[model samples]
Target: MRRVLIIGGGVAGCATALALHRAGFAPVVFEGHPDSGEDIGAFLTLAANGMAALRELDAAIAVGRAGFPLHTLEFAGGVRELAGHRCLRRAELCRVLQAEVARRGIPLHHGKRLASAAEDADGITARFTDSGIARGDVLIGADGLNSRVRALVSPGAKPRYAGQQVFYGYSRPRRPPCEPGRIVMVRGEAAFGFAVSPGGETYWFARVSTVESPEPSWRESLLALLDKDCAAIVAATRGPVLGTNARDLAQIPRWRTDRMLLIGDAAHAASPATGQGASMALEDAVVLAKAMRDTANPLEVYEQLRRPRVEYNTEASGRMSARLPPMDVPPPVSEEELAGQLDWSRRVELTAAE
Candidate 1:
């Protein structure tokens, strides 16, 4: 069996571990964080494609327990019913996935930040900041945007600002503007979105175009940019607002070496405007595990299958961040083709073009 060393125990790392274990590989996770509450203040939504990937790993039900389902999207355009989506706290999702990994007796070590890695013909050894080491047949970097492994794989591949600042917060409005299971998008001077939970809490996020970093009173500045209802929601926030610069890796010329590979945000991170970061990571886990199970050159095959789709998302998201109109770019793959690619029972296959 191939022993896979996985770095970063966030969404990508945990999901990769579960998928690899199910495919009969020995995969161990090494996380830099001392605990699982790394991004406790942030929240995200898993679209239908992401939910489908979890289902392929048989983990949808376990993860479904933490988040509530979202069924409708309301915007300047008419409302539309969604296929299958879930909204939840980022830390809560990590907790659920990590708990599932533990339930299956997988090895997960925390606070062991990756320092460096050396690869040989036979295997690769990962050295951690804690002076710990592990030898594995291959290394998979499932780290986040500021990934250390990415530096080793492709030097000078840094994250570029996607031209926006993202802010997140929760509010308890006595009278919620929208019903539960519905996400309302407000497109004013800035792009804003909010979803009300069954318990009457409102989860909202805003993306504002800006080159400079936000000030200490970003909340007040953001309020000034929003309309009356949106401003009211921000004013009624339950706690301090959380904000961050939107960043992404527009392109990475190299994704792997002889015995090392990059996956998830470490490989292809898109801006939050798309809201496809976690979903894309989940899809990577499933496709990569299948490749490892059925290919002689798993790394090469994995990149061929994933690069086109992820790059398309990166480009589209960047355009949205810049407040540009939608381009007529063709999708990398059709929904039917993607379904076939993610299907676990079927053997992995790629078209001639891919």
Candidate 2:
């Protein structure tokens, strides 16, 4: 049996562990963070394709219980409606995935940051920042945007910023304004989005176009960006806000070497605007595992199958990022066009990943 070393205990890594385990491999997941249930990230929307991938792993019900399913997504004051979207706290998603991993008795190590790695004809050895080492027949990089493994595989590659930053926050209002499972988005100066979860918590995000970082804090930046039309959202959200830069990797020329492979954000990160980051990572996990199941040269086959798909998403996301209009201005895309994009994204199929 091959011992697979999976780097980064994130969505990609955890899902990969589960998939690999099902494929008859003993996989160990290494996480740089000491704890997997850190409540630090914002909410994530899992589209239909992502849910389908979870269903492939028999994980849809668990994750669905952790998130809110959206029945309607309205943009630009109800000009269009997007279907088949779901929302969940990113931390909750991680907690649920980690719990599933624990239930299966998978070996997961914390504080195992990858400082470097080297490959031999027999296998690969990963060295951690803490001076620890682990050897396995296969090494998979699931580390995020600044993946150490990525730098080693493609020395010239780096994350490309999307010229925008997003601030996300969850607020419990005395009375939620939006209907449960309904999401509303407005395009002005910047983009302001609001949605009410099943638990009655309102999740909101504001995306502002800027190369320079916002001042005061994420919450302050959000309050300042919203116009009078969205004053209610500004007034409703009083809790702490989390911020993340929108970024993607454009046409990465490398994804694998003998005995090693890269998956998820480590290989091809897409902007949040595309709403494909989490879903794409989920797809990568299942597809790579299937490739492993079917071939002797799994890394090569995985790269061939995944690169074109992720590259297409990367390019689409880049185009979306470039289309963000100036502040206080309305978006350039028409209602029909916006709806078309949303529908297209939701329709992306991952059944083949199973």
Candidate 3:
């Protein structure tokens, strides 16, 4: 049996473990986080392509049951509505995915961060920060944007700041009941997006061009920056703001070595504007596992087919980020242009390895 060692226990690592397990490969997942049930993050929308990839890996049904789907996504406060969108609590999605991984009996080691990896003719060996080691026939790097595996493969590669910062939070208002089935986005001094999930909880995010992350009062800061209409949405919210710096890895020249492969953000990281990061990771997991099952040189096949697709999205994300107008200004891209980007993102589908 060919044992596979996977890094990062997030969406990509867990999905890869599940796919590889189904493909008759023994896979062990290593995560830097210490808990198997650690789910802390902002909300995310798993567009159609992301949903399709999860269906391919048999992970979507479970996720759908746990998370709600989006029937319509309204941009610039209903200026445009994109059909077929879904929103999920980031923590909930991780919890569900990890549960699926556990149900499949895949070995997942939390707190096992990858420090370095060494490859030879026989196989590859991964060294963890805790001094633990793991050996496998091949290693899959799903460790995300700042992947150590990626550094080992291409030392020159790094993520570039996308010139945007985001804050996320959940709100429940008694005066104005939360409405479900629509995601409303408002563009003004900054970008404010909010959607009511099927569960009636409001998930909102505020995007600004601040290079330096705001203080703990992120929500208040965002509230102050937003226009009165958008500010009302955040002002009615109640919770701590989850802040994240947006980054883009334009493209990577190398995605694999003879005995190692990089998948998910490690290989190509797109900006949040695309809403395809999770989808791409899910797609990579399924495709790579299928490739491994069918081909002797799985790494080569994975890279050849996956790189171009990821690079295209990365480029598109960069362009979209660059086009975002300044505070209190109109969006650089028109509704038609934004619709085109949405179309491209929603149309992404996974293909089985040849």
Candidate 4:
């Protein structure tokens, strides 16, 4: 039996472990957090491809709990339907993955922040801040966007900020909520806001175009900017803010050195503009697992099989990103506009950028 050590137990890490186990290989997972049950305050969409991968891990039934069908998505003039869509809470999604992993008797080590790693021809060894170490015939870094493992693998793979920033909020329905049958996206100049469902929890992400400002510390500077653009969604929130810098990286030419390889965000990060980050990462995990299972030289197989997918997705995300407008314009600009934003009788229509 072959042993694998995987770093980062978020969506990508847990999925990879489960997939590997089903492929007759069990992988030990290391999560930087103190526990495997904390909520990340974000929801992810499991597209067709992603859903297929989870089913392969025997996790679809559980995944159903973590996610509702994201069947409909709409884009329009800054305020899409306030309701109607299949959604789930981010917490629910993680819980589902973690539960499946536990049921399989997979070992998961939390609070084990990766400190350093060295890969030899035979295997790879990883040192953690928790004063522990793990070694395996193969090492995979599923650590998220800011992947420490990636740094060690390809030092030159710097993340280029995707000139967009998103402010996310979690909330419950107030009175009659936005229509509940679709993922709603409101588009405007250099900004767009969306409402999504995860674990039955309502989630919103507001993106502001950073190209106009060109500032590295734009998050601080653009506080007012986001607030203005995402007025409708902001007003509807009933929970704490789940925020982070929106950024992405394509790939590292030398993703593998000996028995180690990088996967998911560590290898490539697509912009969230197209909302495909989670879906693509899911594909990366399963694709890599399949490649490894089919070949003796897992590294070579994983590299060749996943590179094209990563590159294609990366380019698609960038192209979609370039079409977004720069931040600066405010929404309806008043509570009255919010009230009169959409008429129930009139049909609202949206067209993607040409």
Best candidate, lDDT-wise?
A: 1
Question: TM-scores, in order shown?
Answer: 0.97, 0.87, 0.86, 0.79
Candidate 1 minimal-lDDT segment of 10 residues: 211-220
Tens-place lDDT per residue, model 2, 1-354, is 289999989898998888788667899999999998245648889987777677767788999988878888788656445565679888888888888888898999999999989999898999999999999998999998888888888888999778878778777667786899888888887788888877787888877787845442555556676787465665677667777777788878888888778899999998887678988888787777776776666777667667766777777777666773334534344445323322312322233333
Error of 2 at 153 (Å): 0.7
Q: Name the regions of candidate 3 deviating beyond 4 angstroms.
A: 37-39, 76-84, 174-178, 214-217, 324-354
What's the number of clashes in each of the models?
A: 0, 3, 2, 21
Q: In model 1, which residue pairs have backbone atoms overlapping below 3 Å?
A: none
Model 3: how far residue 189 lies from native, Å: 2.2
> What does candidate 4's lDDT look like per residue over 10-97, in tens digits?
8889988987887779799999988764466666666655665666667767787555665556665343332212355556767778
Instruction: Flag the better candidate by lDDT, 1 or 3.
Output: 1
> Would you give me the overall lDDT of model 2?
0.78
Q: What global local distance difference test value does model 3 have?
A: 0.76
lDDT of 1 by residue, 243-269 (tens): 899899978989999988999999999
Model 4's alpha-carbon lDDT is: 0.66
CA error at residue 234 for candidate 4, angstroms: 1.8
